[model samples]
Target: MKPVSSECAVGIDIGAGSGAKMGLFTREGNLLGESLLPIERYGRSPVVMVGELAGALRDLVKGSGSPPLIGAGVAMPGFACSDGTVRCNNLPFLDHVPFVPMMEQAFGLSVCVVNDADAGGLAEWSHARTELLYWVFGGGWGGAWISADGQVRYPAVDWDGDDDTLHYSNEPGYAIPLSRERMGVELASLGGSWEGFERICMAEREWPGGRLAGPNGRLDCVRAELFVSGNGRWRIFRTLAAADGYDLARLTPEERQALETPSNAGRVIDRLAEQGCPVVRRTDLMFGRALAAAAEFHFRSGPRGNCPDGIAIYVGGKPSRALPWFGPEAESVMRARRLHASLKLSWFSERNLNANLAGAAVLAWNRLKGS
Candidate 1:
């Protein structure tokens, strides 16, 4: 008797600003292969996007030697709707588009969709099956809450376009506010300036993408994302340098220029932090504090009865690769505040898995099993 082939799933991660990644994975979550589709290939045409994505999916399935496909799960950088539509701000072309159904219709495959950040959480949940916070630090901080039962709690599916209505678990960076007064205190201790930081924020802040208001539309505080993100960390570095009088003797101008690249800045900061550069160390400390501040609000005001006291925060995203530098400080501060939660590097990170794609695969497999 011949052995039956294992069933696989298709996982597609769509980045609004970037492009799309498609991967084939077995039921056990091992990736068989993957492909990339550039945004330019699809452009703004929904028909084109769907056609290209269909080809990619077919290629993945064919490349896997005609293994039975469980289903397809798509991850997007936007809020997902029940009717297979997505509201993507960055990819204006995809906003209000029935993206999931389009892809499914094109390829005649069962398909599901989820927010990218939530997808990352599902990836972690697939491993731990516990209540946790999944936070991704990029240009903006994105997040999700996974229940102990492996469901995404408080997903932003029904968002009304008001930042204030978003739940802390679903949008911690946008809904949580780091205290301005506390920031001033943190800055003063390290010879940094709150005024200078504000100035930089004002100059760099983009419309609609950033908000000066805090949780519930309070004006006295800044959204946690303004300081806890990739570019946000760079802003901290810039502000501290200007305030404390940058010591170029320790870091060359060329190195300083390299730090301006968000993709490369985390590595540079990690190296400099290891070398004990005062500014880099202090900047990380400040960033960590803001991160703690977000967590504090989440635990204190979130669905406390549902989650355990020591809920783990699984960190994701390229920027979070620097968690080894900032996570310790955040953990320490949370401990000092008596918040029992721990800041943990994501399971995806430890396993060297691409969080979005892996998570999408898990989601697809689960849907196929009627979970």
Candidate 2:
């Protein structure tokens, strides 16, 4: 293993849901510590919130004995310039915010900013075996091709027609119309957003037995029936359930009971199985397929031999939430059933230091040393 440099880099990922997490990654890919903070929406004033966030980070580092700082990497939800000008439609307040300079001045450290999905892809590529990898999250997607020699081929940036070089942008969601079309209706019906679908799906799964309820009372059945009627929602639910292990007969009983108790969206799968749907509970195929599609696109779009091995770094709640139905064994089973490319899911939760942060640190260390 390569030794990390004396300097450290921080990877700050800002989620669209107003949550922020900063990971302090050493050159050896060791996450020294992390801080999660909530963002308050105060009308186009992200600078204030982010400044406060930086202050919190400073306090964390100072309290932890003041390790030497080197550079920082940020992952934001919108298109970002090399200098860190962010234009996130969702974060209207952050549009055109000079976040990089603000943080750099606040922390007295160098800062590098990238799109959130791009950072995820970079983190994933840092651990990937293949040279080329594609990554996607709920709102957007991106790709990165890593050479065996460790050179990263980023999508070109079109800066005033002066910096027109080939850079890889993980804007797959923008390029792939079908992906958005597939989920459009469901997203709208479900309150015109996909922010918490994963949590919602999990709630539906655990409803009758879990803890979510409605105004009338326990809402297991009502929610399930509404989800079933929606095309995208139904498909996503069915696919996830299939990945888990429920059979058709079990699904039917659950669905019937859910009809009586709408909030029972949690048990719809079991009910559907009982009613004779050939569905089985499985991992969230939507997330898996979206990621696979992005990778596939990257593999097929460029020079064939130049394509690098693929990797994916998933940063979210938990594999259980994102990959709820499938366990490690089930991943292979699901792959076999789908007969698609062999894509693997590696969990990189914050709780696990080695799995999540080490690889990126090592990769960064190698990059800085020109290895």
Candidate 3:
């Protein structure tokens, strides 16, 4: 038999607001060459964007001087269906766009379009071939479940709400406070009343500030998830600030700057922990437990219960990468449940900064192999 060609593939990660990044990767997940272009460089025109992306891909392959490119993969921030239609709220240009066909035509290769979060999950699963629960904690929180065979379960079943993204702010139980009558019983054991808690939250006097306070705050409808890194960190900061001894003044200008823009919040929280703030640890623990609770909730009611055991949780994005303790903290929460399944945590970048791209390439490589 003629030996099969061991050619490389191309992967493109196109995230909203971050422009486009393309890379050449061997089937083994090694990044061979990479290139980038700011989204604005294309003037937000789809035709122009695809043309620019195609040029970048050509440059990446040519620059690498690697094997023939066999396939291509594209990752973007949006809801992409297997049929190639994408509904992107963040990348308005991609709304109802058939990006797969566009890329395929541009590059003359089989192309796959996947959600950015699912791309991360695919990368993690490729490393272990285990049941993977990968969460990307960047601008916002997103998660994907992969079967042991590396099949990603898409269109994650929504949890008891109209919201799509999984964050505490949108989760039913955590989204708001219980009613006054309901709170009486809920808080009776804790020796506090719902009314009292609402007062503090409404006054912005304590934990659960205006965003999570008042009857209006407590009974608000589903809001958009905080996909912005700065917003996510601000949420963490406010939650931690509620606890006693949290020195708000210790915040650096950079840290404070994160609160105003969409940036990595995990790094700031980790820095605060390094600064000797006990509240940071406490908040991390809370956040970790919240993640566990989300997992448990999904296992019980969501669509991920089938492969509970052998599950590995991969954490990445700017924040989780900076905070090494994030995994353990979340693991502690998962273990505390004493459930049927065991979970493990690791970084998505255990291989490279181009983990998403690596996974996209892997998906394309696998597609070619299957064909």
Find the candidate with the highest lDDT and give its number.
Answer: 1
Q: Alpha-carbon error at 128 in model 2, in Å?
A: 3.6
Tens digits of per-residue lDDT for model 3 on 1-371?
23224578788888776688888777777777788888777967888888888888777666676457888877777666666767777888777777778878998888877777777778887777777777666655666777777877753222333333333212223222223353334233333343443443345334344354322344432122221122434454454465353565667777776644435455566677787666555555544544555555555544324446435656666666534444565566567775444444444555347567767777777667552
lDDT of 1 at 312: 84
Pairs with steric clashes in candidate 3: 19-39, 139-227, 140-227, 230-263
- Predicted candidate 2 versus true structure: per-residue lDDT over 176-225, tens digit per residue: 22233334333444233333444545544554445433213333312221
lDDT ranking from best to worst? 1, 3, 2
Instruction: Give the residue spans of candidate 2 off by over 4 A.
Output: 1-6, 41-44, 139-143, 156-169, 179-298, 301-340, 349-371
TM-score of 2: 0.58
Pick the winner on lDDT between candidates 1 and 2: 1
The TM-scores, one per candidate, come to 0.92, 0.58, 0.76
- Residue 348 error, candidate 3, Å: 3.1
- Residue 23 CA error for candidate 2 (Å)? 2.6
The TM-score between candidate 3 and the true structure equals: 0.76
lDDT (Cα, tens digit) per residue for candidate 1, span 1-371 = 23327888888999876689999888777887799999988999888999999988777677767677888988988898898888998788889998878888897889988889989999899887778889888888989889888788887685788866777777777777888898888888877878888877777646443656676668788888889898889889888988878876666777777776665677677777788888888898888988887787777874532355588888888777778778898999999999888888887787666899988988888777655
